[model samples]
Target: MKKFTQYVFCITILLSCKKIGTPELQPINLKISTVYASTELGKKLSLSKVLIKILNVNTNVEKQLITDANGNVSFQGISAGVYDISATITIPAATYSSVTGEIVDKDVIFNASDKNKTIGLTNNELNIKLVSGNIGNWLIKQIYYAGSNTTTGAGYRDQFIEIYNNTDSVMYADSLYFAEIIGRQSYTNTSYYTLPNGQMDWSKSLNMPSNIDANNNYVYPRALFMLPGKGKEHPVLPGASIVIAQTAINHKSPFTGTDGKTITVRDPSLTIDLSGADFEAYYAPFLPRPLTSDIDNPSIPNLNVLAYNGTDMLFDNPGRTAFIIFKRDGTEVKDYPKYNYPTISTPSSTSDKFYQIPNSVIIDAVEIQPNTASDRVPKKLGASLDAGYTFAPNGQYSSQSVIRKTDRTENGRKILKDTNNSTEDFDYFSLANPRGFK
Candidate 1:
């Protein structure tokens, strides 16, 4: 009886041991989804494929499951209890068409699990816009001032003009001039100045600024003066002429008319009425002189003047001088000599010395009302400093912030989370680690 009872106890112990040795099973579920996509122009997107990874903590083993076409994916039958779970997606170099498509990369991280728990994600469709050109459709439009009514005196007034160049090609308009008319000559003697037609100016002589941009035009009010004995010093005189001439005409021409040695003004519009006393011309407001053309009648409003002092016709520096001294109307504000030479000097020269130069006389300072809103305009600080500079590709990465810390060893990281290209200055991580490139 004792032997039989012992045998039954041994069998019971063995059954208990077998039960204790059995392994416990835990289940876990994982799911992944794309949350956002890239849409701005010049961006590279890779949010198409998604994957979820299930890992065994004790055995250091992992399994992967791919998501659906819409970046929707799931993982089931994962061991529970703080398992090391990860997710991954590869962004293949997107197949693109010329009509419009995506160019995806071969590798990029799409998504990952958070806190080793079943995480839910909603993938957002990425709409990436591509560009064939930089600064597309943006042209070098006209130059302009803030507005009118900001003009001060000769140097204080704010005035600017527009030069529109819509094409990508570079452009240049040099030797331009601007001026008002003083008076017209009698039919016989063409020596006297004539009235201006349609945006016309004195074309016989011009003093163009040195540095002008080819692509972009500029506008600014400037004090102007003619070369020694070139044109009339009194603009706005009854029937006066304003012209814009090339620098080659700086020297006097010996062309004679019915009267005597009368100058011949050419016109591009082919409207030259040689018999008429006045003609047309085109001159920018800030230019120092004008070109000669045919002038039937000018419709541009003549600038009105309130006061003019003949003695002080230029600034103390003498680099700039008023060639014509008169009010807006036919009346002469101050009678300047028929001609006066202007002296040019550097900044080191004293104002008094510059005005007293030999052979080159300086005009006195004149007070004119403000013409435009340029006085209140601020100078662009950034444009002048870094006019031509760009960033290096390798160094550009330093400027960006990393949104996702990927595990390369796990082979479970999403491929969309990687960027191996240079980023545009304005690009940012607004979507699921997607970048823009054009």
Candidate 2:
């Protein structure tokens, strides 16, 4: 019994002597700041927003804090450790191309204290340069599908940006860098092919015996050519920039080719006649049936435009005027006259069918007298009719008789009239140009 009592006493003593430890919490305080580009004496750099990233080395966790408009940021109650803090300054879009673009990137490090205190960092601005003017020449022509029209067609579309020797004389190909800017990266597609040494093959530069207007010297000029439907070809989205070299604008030509300074890169802004030459586009309009549908689905009647880029594409919707033809059954219809323009209506949406007009039919011309004061051309071309519509009987549709005067800014940055309406009540149709270059 005495031995049992002694064992219980030892156990009690052991329990009473137990030790518990409390962890010591060390609170941390940090402050971060950023600077912008400056050029004046003691000029303080400003930032739209600043971000500070504090990293804890032991746990490998990060804590982020954002600065106010005054370029001040702070972090509190942080875990105590040797933290590495970096600052980032953000520039707004309006200032992005202006002042912020000129700034270069700079980084700085800071340490947080165990107590609250003001910590300032400097020169955390990112270096950038503003691209004020246009960079390159090569303007993209048509990016179309090799076969049919589908969103996937964008992937299969053969892309080409036609480079113009806007400069009178021919330039060297070696001095130029032809490329597409996709995001932050620039892609180059320069060829060693001698460009515009003024040489041409017989079949390449030959003009038809009867037609003199379509005759040209070069065959495939210094244009960026890519095979459509090929895996991972040139892919472009809206607002993508295409660049060309101003110095190396010209290319070399093979032997016996015309080295004359007569090579002209066609401007897509001009009116390309379907019957005239300079039309080389790859299209497969006729596909075997059992396919899903044509280029557009759920198309609207009296509407025929594929894409709109402020007149960049043939179907530019200045006011979202771009439309596709649709039957009453919600299917796309591509028949001529099924979709045109200058459609008629009763000012109400209930009207079933209205007469329409095409957007490209030419009407008349007015002669202007020669005047030294004005550098105007001798004649001004008029539209076939205006852009309004007229009412007609049930069987007879309204005709686009008057000219529709709508302003359009062409590739040349010139405002041209959308002159195609004649009677305002006629059949609507898309322009029948195979190559969508013009």
Candidate 3:
């Protein structure tokens, strides 16, 4: 009897050890739902066949599944951990136009993402609402904020941005405006005015109109420039792109700086030749002491600078900035009000002011943050404009760039992805490419 009791104790101990070795995993049941910007179209949209992806944040393991006719999907025996869930669906143009009475030449993509979600031992049903975004005809194709090597490459002088005509028809670039979005760059100062997300609370700025929803409805610009063209003067054909450079010159070869000095790169291959750039930013006239590299190319047109910042059109090399493109609307941008930072309770007469641009007029926007997650600031663009942000994975001075992904080619025309989520819609190029497709 004593031996039998000892044997039972040993079996119980082994069973306990086995349970500890393999903890019970939980199941995740997800429901996919469609949310239309137009409520009328919501009733007509279908929810089945949506692709859902769940990523284990800790393990980087991803699982993909499709929703059934009832918009239901399940993942059994998933380890409890932090996860990121995303869903995407494409609706045919004909179907979308027929349901909404809107005409679109290409399919519309709807995307949704829930980040840093925790799934514990308790299983629960989560509903993901897919949102359709504004289909933009002219989109920001690529951004080269990560300039070349400081010692061996062109440095910030090689930075450029490309804009593409995403539609099949010709779109004139007349009076189209683009700007470098400005916001609070730090997160440590709690005494300053900030939004719930820790972004600058522009509504708190002195002399800011109280009637308007400044925080959500508008964005401030550090620099604003307009593409030079009369109506139909600058026709961008379908699948074509225009490159805008800081200095329109061949960076691969030695060039004469504005200071009458020679500037050369140790490695020409690390930089690109922008002599053929369609437009360049000339800031010498605006700055008291302009950067020597801010040379102008007479052949290439200069963007009309409405608002200037820094000594030149230099992007933040550390990738702490956002950009947006819009067109002239009923209200003139020059007439828009400017205000000082909200942190200043009393502003002097000569305080620097930032131009407030209405979100309704913005055509496209992309938010960029530091490659290191800990240094990231609050999102400047809202979810409606850009649900996610992207950056050059290699960081500053790496000659890398964030380029939009190609969704598919229809009739040999490249249709770049524009799901209002840069993280999902963009990919990085090891080197910056002007007028190049990914």
- In order, the Cα lDDT scores of the candidates are 0.25, 0.24, 0.84
| lDDT of each residue in 1-438, candidate 3, tens digit only | 999999999999999988886654435454434354445666778778888888776676988888777566787667777676777778999998998788888788777766556676563457666666677989999999999998999999999999999998999887899999988787886645897667888888988888999987889989899998878888899999999899999999998887799999999999998999989999988788888888889999999999987887888878878999998678888998898888746767888899989888889999898887556677787656776778999999999999999999999999998988888889999999898888
**TM-score versus the correct structure, for each prediction:** 0.21, 0.20, 0.82
Estimate, for each residue in 1-438, the C-alpha lDDT of model 2 and write its tens digit.
999999999998776655321122445455554443234311433443455555553454778877687656667766555443444333433544354345323222111111111122332222221111111222222211111122211111111222222222333222122211100000121211111211111122212223321112111111111222233233332222222111111111111212233322232221122222121222113223311211211121111222112111221111111111111222221222211111222123442221221212111111111111121111111111121111111111111011112133335432222212211112221221222222
Cα deviation of 226 in candidate 1 (Å)? 61
Best-matching candidate per lDDT: 3
Cα shift from native, residue 259, model 3 (Å): 2.5
Instruction: Give per-residue CA lDDT, model 1, range 1-438, as digits (tens).
Output: 999999999999999888875433434344445433234321444344444454443444667666565555556644444333333433443433221264432333233332222222221112111111111111111111111111211110111211122222332222112221111112233332222211111222123223433111211122332222224432322111222221111111224322344543232121111122111222323234322221112332222222222211112121111111111123222332122111222223332111111111211111111112121111110111111111111121111111222213223312121221111111222111111111
Task: Tell me the spans in candidate 3 whose CA falls farther than 4 Å from its real position.
Answer: 1-87, 97-106, 113-130, 344-349
Q: How close is each model in CA RMSD to the real structure?
A: 31.5, 28.3, 5.6
TM-score of candidate 3 against the unseen true structure: 0.82
Give the poorly placed runs of model 2, Cα more than 4 Å off.
1-25, 37-45, 96-438
The local lDDT score (0 to 100) that residue 389 gets in candidate 2 is: 16
**How much is the lDDT of residue 15 in candidate 3?**
92
